[model samples]
Target: MVENINIRVANLQENYLIAKHLYLMWQDIGVPDESIQSNWLEITKEYIDNARHKLFYQAFIADISNTIVGSVSCKIFAGLYPNIIKPEYRKQGYIWGVYVEPDYRRQGIAKKLMEEAIAYLKSISCTKVILHASPQGKPLYSHLGFDENNEMGLDLS
Candidate 1:
């Protein structure tokens, strides 16, 4: 059946489902190993819940048949690079947790969710929008004006 899928702002009420989807996405990206499954689930839940309260922007969820099949969130922060570099801080946002069900792939769902995230970030006066895109999503983000940059990472363990 061709059902109507609606993309709307995710509320705190949907935190669990959102967290579940995020956990699945992380597994899909090879970031969460089998040994970390339980720990990661708790971490994802707590983080998703906290972002709902702390972030200035909203998370978007695409619901089809009352199931959240796609999700994306933008984080907006008012600060310079690390905020210690300069006192004059501008707003920045990031698109994250972008996922669509396997069966729902290539159906323009991810594009729609990303459009929502971009629009929301822009509405919040975000000067930049960043995301660590998966290989499958790189082309989509590139087509939408996101480019590759030499990004560095640090592991604080």
Candidate 2:
């Protein structure tokens, strides 16, 4: 299955498909439809706009038999703290919206997408990368050498 997969850079024309994959990823992680459906289009539009800007955004898709089966998006971090960090530790890249169709799971498609995203970040001189891993994805990320950070969160609701 992995042998037949091809990784390619995504364009604005594929924004809708990327958005669909993102929605599926969220759903697979148990995000409520009510929360995702209501603003899906807007969110997709924002992705398109960000991708178009190209200052810090890029998306990649996994193609199998000319069909998109998985996707991952990456962005260069523009946070204020990054500006203060040492040069070698600055210019962080963030990976997100990783998804593979149910039928494509366990086929290494996600890994390929991540490799492509990481290569892109490296080409752009990103010194570090980060992602918020879903429970199902933690193992894969860990295998890829991604370490856990000390981020904490609380629900005000």
Candidate 3:
């Protein structure tokens, strides 16, 4: 539990920082450098911009005395199937790009960011929040009340 850390919503101009953090997150998850696009930052920024404008996308950052140390992004979940359910019961929020500076790990910054995201989703009447958690993030997310989802994946390579 780190003291004096500030968690706040990210501003529009800070999308690039959020994008960079996402790229770093990929690397941290052992994505080969060659597997990521060279222009990943631009692509991610574009996605964030579009999502922000259209899908209620929001991002949060953790700062320690004015220096950013972590970030998380969330938005309305674009479902894979056709949606017929009412918004009040089936509206889902998605969370992604959760990252923390290596030096700041284990200090509760990530938990704070997650709690903030969950609050935002709840405020919008989201019935559930979803994320594909990396192995490293599973414990923290589990502790935050997230449950195992019904999603399945297959290797297409």
Q: Candidate 1's error at 117, in angstroms?
A: 0.8
The model with the greatest lDDT is: 3
- lDDT of candidate 3 at residue 144, scale 0 to 100: 95
- Decoy 2 TM-score against native: 0.91
Best by TM-score: 3
TM-score of 3: 0.98
Give the alpha carbon lDDT tens digit for every residue of 1-157 in model 1.
2348899998877767767777778788787466456676678777766665787757888888787788887776543346553313456687888888888878888888999999988887777788888888899999899988888779998
Off by over 4 Å in 2: 80-82, 86-88
Candidate 1: Cα lDDT at 58:
74
Question: Considering only N, C-alpha and C atoms within 3 Å, which residue pairs clash in candidate 2?
Answer: none
lDDT (0-100) at residue 150 of candidate 2?
A: 90
TM-score of 1: 0.82
Residue-wise C-alpha lDDT for candidate 3, range 3-100, written one tens digit per residue? 99999999988998998999999999999999999999889999998899898999999999999999999999989899899998799999999999
* TM-scores of all candidate predictions against the true structure: 0.82, 0.91, 0.98
Which ten residues in a row are the worst by lDDT in model 3?
Answer: 144-153
